[model samples]
Target: MIEQFLTSYFVKNGEHLEVPPKYISDTIKQYTVAKQTARTYRNVSFLKVGQLTKTKPSQELINYKFTKNAKRKLTEDFSTIQSWIKEGWIIEEIVFAQDGRTAKAIHYRIGPSLKYYFDAQNEQQTQRLENYVLQLQKSADIQPIKELLQAVQQLNEFVAMPIEKLAHTTKLTPHWSIEKRLRFLHFSIGFFQLANEGVLFDFKEIGATLFDKIGGSKAFDRDQKEFIEELERVFSVQTIDCGLISLGKITPVFFTGELMGHLAIIDKVLFMH
Candidate 1:
């Protein structure tokens, strides 16, 4: 329950707040009471931030004893919660009374360092990318891609093709079938993965290359625009002008996950072959 409270607090605020020790206990009590009163009352807000004071806490809170085990659990839960924050994850500052004999309140805020938190996020993002690839494979038409990869591997005459020529030569019909579109996306994914690895220059280059793949400037304007739009939406892709006198230059803003090493699984045509 304490962990949930802390997690939600971080998610909602994405900042630090000074919380009273008694307030935490009270909040937990409210949560327990809410659960008991109504099963539907599952989520309770814990956004309250208390001001620190040099004076002693009120008698009611002082009389309210927080268990030693509970404190330990809260500490452990906070350590776990800190793993989720990317920025100043959490800073705990103890405010002591003027007498210097007793602690007053603990100040919580975004801190400066949390290396392990980002490491955890990277692992999760990588896993998400892997899962996305696996899911994409289930629906994407990839048999032709596999065969094309094999053929390319066996051929020595075929050097890597230039982006402009490929776009100029290949022409998309007025309409694209769903199967054909998915097949095209399969290749786009390969290009994106390659770009992620720094093998390709960037998203703009990938865009221009892909723009040509879909039939270049000669293709119908509506179809080309729609295809490019979908690519941008799915992969955080963007297009740029390389002064090629056309939409031959492109760039990508971001790729979701790291799948460069696992090319065979993500996109076999470019990486596997």
Candidate 2:
């Protein structure tokens, strides 16, 4: 009964409800059991709000009545409410009443995971949620990510080959600058990662940029074809339609720890040159 009332309240308001015990006591006094229970508990477990409808609460009257036992049941459910607080579903705090500091109310402020309570609602509520998420994303720290990438690049397990060694091994042209070699290696790693993830490739755009100094579309097609052929020969990658098709041979190995370590090495080799 409490859950139904709260759901309705949150959906209608899309804001925190100052629900006192008396409010619950009064609300549940309106309806009978079996029928209301059958209507409200439609296979949804209590507080599993995600499975429920993504609609705002209606102004329609709720018609459930609470018996004496039902009232007792509500009181005994404080432990469940406390558990919600621990799980961060609800934020609880005390605030002084307008009249005096002695008179306090336990304010159930909505937490960051407030989306779970209500679904698709008014533009105002949706905008509020979007703004909140944007603020959080804007405040997010990226230094740790850079540090982790740097660490991956430094680790020997992920360092397949140093730039000089790689150039020598591949027999890259003598005229190729270290910067150009690095760029080529990075592109190879990116191509492999994309293919392994079964992503589609846009050969025209990619080839135009990478092979721009060499020639036009035809040269790009030739170079990318060679690149794809080498990948198929070495990594056993499967592709069709001149490498534009999704490749899948590496997908299964992509998540394995050893393969991931090698991928990190590829990332290192990509940048080191």
Candidate 3:
């Protein structure tokens, strides 16, 4: 039945059937026989007649020998093989080849049949399966941009405060010594220098024109202390010098605080170090 089905379905078309090319060659050898006989010529010259005959094998003739052999080697192997073939777990195709001395031979293309089974399956089903797998892979890949975006939004809101009111509300505390103030100012300047370009600073030269407006380090320290105190009072935030000032949270209005001015803290010394 299988051979008949293959013959009818694959052989009718001029195009070779989808069988293994080797199978086609083997089939041609198995089913074709050549007979040679002496023939008499009219001129009394001897001639040899070579006749090639083609025959179709019966279902029993084409029965799979491996099935029986496999069953003998391992019990139930034949049944398993039959089941796989019937369920489209194996597939076969017809192929053709030309010979220099004789007519072309027919071969079969054979392989595991799952591909043929799916050949008849719905395209949309296949696409859905592929898309599902892709989605699974995409989900497995992680991203960190969301948290960064949220942080940026929060920071933007904090830097939107009005400057004048912020400065007025801030006041220096006794705990904030001049030395601490000077250090904070120095650190702030450094942070700004790293964050931006075109900034002028002269930390080594005391008499440099850079500090002329602020009257050098002493005046700069005093101003910074007052400014920070006023900034804290107006923004309702505490300033800690853990290398970088950490104002836990601030409203957008606090950005415009009088002493702090409009500033966005990007990469701080704390994070960089």
Cα lDDT listed for each candidate: 0.36, 0.36, 0.32
**Model 3 per-residue lDDT tens digits across residues 40-136:** 2111111111112223322332343222112212233554534433343333221222322333332222222333333444465556544543433
Once all C-alphas are superposed, what RMSD does model 1 give against the true structure? 22.1
Error of 1 at 49 (Å): 12
Model 1 TM-score on a 0 to 1 scale? 0.20
| lDDT (Cα, tens digit) per residue for candidate 2, span 176-220 | 554444434434444433333344665453434334464533333
lDDT of 3: 0.32
Query: Model 3 off-target regions past 4 Å?
Result: 1-83, 99-113, 116-147, 150-273
Candidate 2: misplaced stretches above 4 Å?
1-160, 170-183, 205-222, 241-243, 246-273
Q: Which tens-of-lDDT digit does each residue in 241-263 have in candidate 1? A: 21112343343455576444544
Question: Which model is ahead, 1 or 2, in terms of TM-score?
Answer: 2
For model 1 the local lDDT of residue 129 reads 46
Worst lDDT run of 10 residues, candidate 1, spans: 27-36
